[model samples]
Target: MVCVPIALIVVVVLIDVLAPPHIHLGPLLVAAPAITASFAGPRLTGLVAALAVAAQALIAVLRDRDELFSANHQAQIAALVLVGASLVVFCVVRERHARELSQVRYVSETAQRVVLRPLPHRIGPLRVASLYLAAEAEAQIGGDLYAVARTGHGTRLIVGDVRGKGMTAVGDAALLLGAFRGAAHRQADLVELVTYLDGSVCWDLAEPGETDRSGETFITATVLDIPDDDDRVDMIDCGHPPPILVRGGRARVINAYQAAPPLGLGDLARPRYHVDSFGFEAGDLLLLYTDGITEARDSAGAFYPLAERIDGWTEDDPAAFLHRLRRDLLDHVGGHMGDDAAMIAIGRAPASRP
Candidate 1:
């Protein structure tokens, strides 16, 4: 690190000596600090800028020629002015970086509050637990999404896999959720709710290159509606992975027939959407996840065993179960996921007297 700073100062001094005096070296002071913050952070950037300005001032003092300015006093003033301007530029760049970071953090926090509500250590007569991970840090939030809404019709929930990743995927995800939340609050039928989400996603992708699935890029989703009255639940699967249901001390993966070819891939002439039904017994658990979990790989090129892990996760409290699963996943891949990973587990309250 010390060698790097010394090397940088050497280069700057060489440029200052070789370049014409009027070459306008403002970029060094104006851009360097802001760029540095991303790599070395704010404090180191400040130190670097201060050191650079001091070096420039020293150069000016050592090589002063009194021909153009015609007076030693005027030359000294010029040197001080240039140094002050450089300092001001560095300070302004630092301030701009701080403001930009503050805004990003604010938006990230707000997105979490609105789009990804914290799982209630418990949810509506059930113990709810979840885990979410984003592969790319640039997107703290990714394309995969899920939400649980208690409504007039039932406690409606849905988990979806958007066609792409990154910002475009996030945009599509926001559209789908906005529709789901709106329809769940108003529409009583599970069929209409899924239809609403499907139509909304298709309409939003009406623009060019939106529906173009680059490589089977389509939104796969499963919508579930568990009525408050009983343990029965109805689901709509659109090519997404079947959620695993653990019950009676045994774990079984719940797979419904392919009702549709996922959202955003449907044509006007295609067959209609079909809703599938299932029953959630008391004391049973359901786990929903995107492809990321099943696709995670170890360096030796082995797929992560999500199903095996879920089997082992049985009988533990929701939190501890999720914790164990998360640790095993990290150990499998050496602490990183290549894509976004999302898991939601909802368990019915323990057995009640008839």
Candidate 2:
């Protein structure tokens, strides 16, 4: 690719030298450095520009040796140098912006890893797989988050989405995740763990001068506890989408009978959190996701049919299942999402083990 611009310069020089002197193809030489700036750095682009200026000088000498210092030749050479120099300047600015963007991306990725650590492929007796899709064009992660923590008796997991998007939502998400990780193991049950998270969110939002919309900001989350010794999973829903249970080639939504208000709204709602138990037998797969997944719309203004699409998907491996779901969801939304989305698939492995 680097040779392409070099060869272009050589070809243009040859054509200009061989053509009638009146044609004056010297102006075409500017293309060489312009092409170089697209793919090469400032130094290389500057080098190419220098070569182009040299070629222009050669053309002038070839056209008329005695008239080398004539006004026409000097103006032509000056124009070529100016254009080439401008291209080199463009390359320098472009490279600097590229470096800055790379640094920003690195920091964003590191923060995402810390706030929403990847779920282990295997957690105790369960096979887990998770996916996060950020709607922000410049961001790789957003307000949607999921995390897993192992306790003495079971594994606790939380999948949540903050009320808004952007940095504010991300801060709220980080706060909730940190709170969950800090108290998930110590808390006696799912209800207590969720209460702690609610309190943490409330405290964070209640901070003065945080935001004008603090009153409207809240997080919808589903907290789950799956004991290693039991076939049942305990859940506490806080105004989140109900998880789907896939068992024996059938999928059904596990709606909570007594749902509570979203976190951060506990003070206003005066809600009572209740622990809901559901059968999560061996070979069962549970999917928890944010509303972004289901609310995504296509060009025709139709929302993605998540449940209908995965109704009979018999893929037992959690990773492969989520992969298929991700592809399908992206296709349904025409490869662009309007909001952040997150999904987690947890499968209970068979009891018989080595």
Candidate 3:
């Protein structure tokens, strides 16, 4: 990049000296700073500007005695100086903005790490893999959240989507995750754990100005329990998208017989959360995802066919299966997601000791 401006200086100087005197090429030096803007920073831009001005002075002095101080030469030198100074200012401003953006990205990354800790590769007997894709690249993590914990009853998990976007929703996700973690071990029952989470969310929502929305903001969540010795899984769906069960290279949604109202909306309607049972034998995988995957759309406005795409991916390994699904989903949406997407893949070990 430094070589680019230096080469431009050399070429422009040679052309100015070798061309016919009737045509002045000294004005071409302005390009040095403009070109430097693309690849180099303010310090290099200033150096290029200095070199250009020096080259202009050398040309003026070496060409002819009268041309050195003539009004035309003075005007050319003034224009060059003005433009070079302006480019230096441009570089300075650009550098400041670059530093500011870097700082903002640093803060965002730290927040994401603290709020959405990475999922472990193995939790109890199930191999686990999780992925999070934020709609805005700058906002590294959003309202979508997932959590896994071992308890007296089984390995408990929750995948949820909050009501809104931005920092407020992220705060809500953190709160819910904290509540689930605290309650999962002590409650010992799926309904009791979910009831604790519901109380926590209702308490948070009842606080005025804690959330941005005025009325009826809620969280849609799915809670799952996989006993270490059992071949079945239990789920409590709170108005969230159903988990998909993959077995024998086939994928099918496991919709609950009756879904309870979303958390924080239980008071509006009498809440009756039911535990839906499903076969989750060895060599089977359960895929839980937020609406972002199903709601993702292509250029033609067609929603992403997540179930159809996963049908062809027979990889039972949680990591590989999720990696393929993420790639295919991005390809379907042309690499732009409109909302935060999160997925958790839990594959039951094929062989377990009795």
Clashing pairs in 2: none
Candidate 1 vs candidate 3, lDDT winner: 3
Of 1 and 2, the candidate ranking higher by lDDT: 2
**Number of backbone collisions per candidate:** 0, 0, 0
For model 2, the superposed segments whose C-alpha errors exceed 4 Å read: 65-72, 132-136, 150-153, 164-170, 185-189, 208-213, 227-230, 255-259, 274-277, 291-304, 326-341
How does each model score on TM-score?
0.66, 0.83, 0.86
In model 1, which regions exceed 4 Å deviation?
1-113, 136-141, 207-217, 351-354
> Considering lDDT, where higher is better, how would the candidates rank from best to worst?
2, 3, 1
How far in Å is the alpha carbon of 89 misplaced in model 1? 18
Model 1: number of clashes? 0
Q: What is the lDDT of residue 174 in candidate 1?
A: 74
lDDT of 2 by residue, 1-354 (tens): 779878988888888889886677788888888888888898999898899889889987877799999998799889988988888889889989989978877777777767788788999999999988867456545678889999999899999888865667778899998898899999987877888888888888778887755559999989999999999999999999999999877899999999999999877887888999999988899999999999999889999987889999999988999999989988988888887789999999899766
Q: How good is model 2 by TM-score?
A: 0.83
- C-alpha lDDT of residue 231 in model 1: 77
Weakest 10 consecutive residues of candidate 1 by summed lDDT: 24-33
Tens-digit lDDT track of model 3 for 65-131: 6668888778877887788788888878988987887887677667766777899998878999998
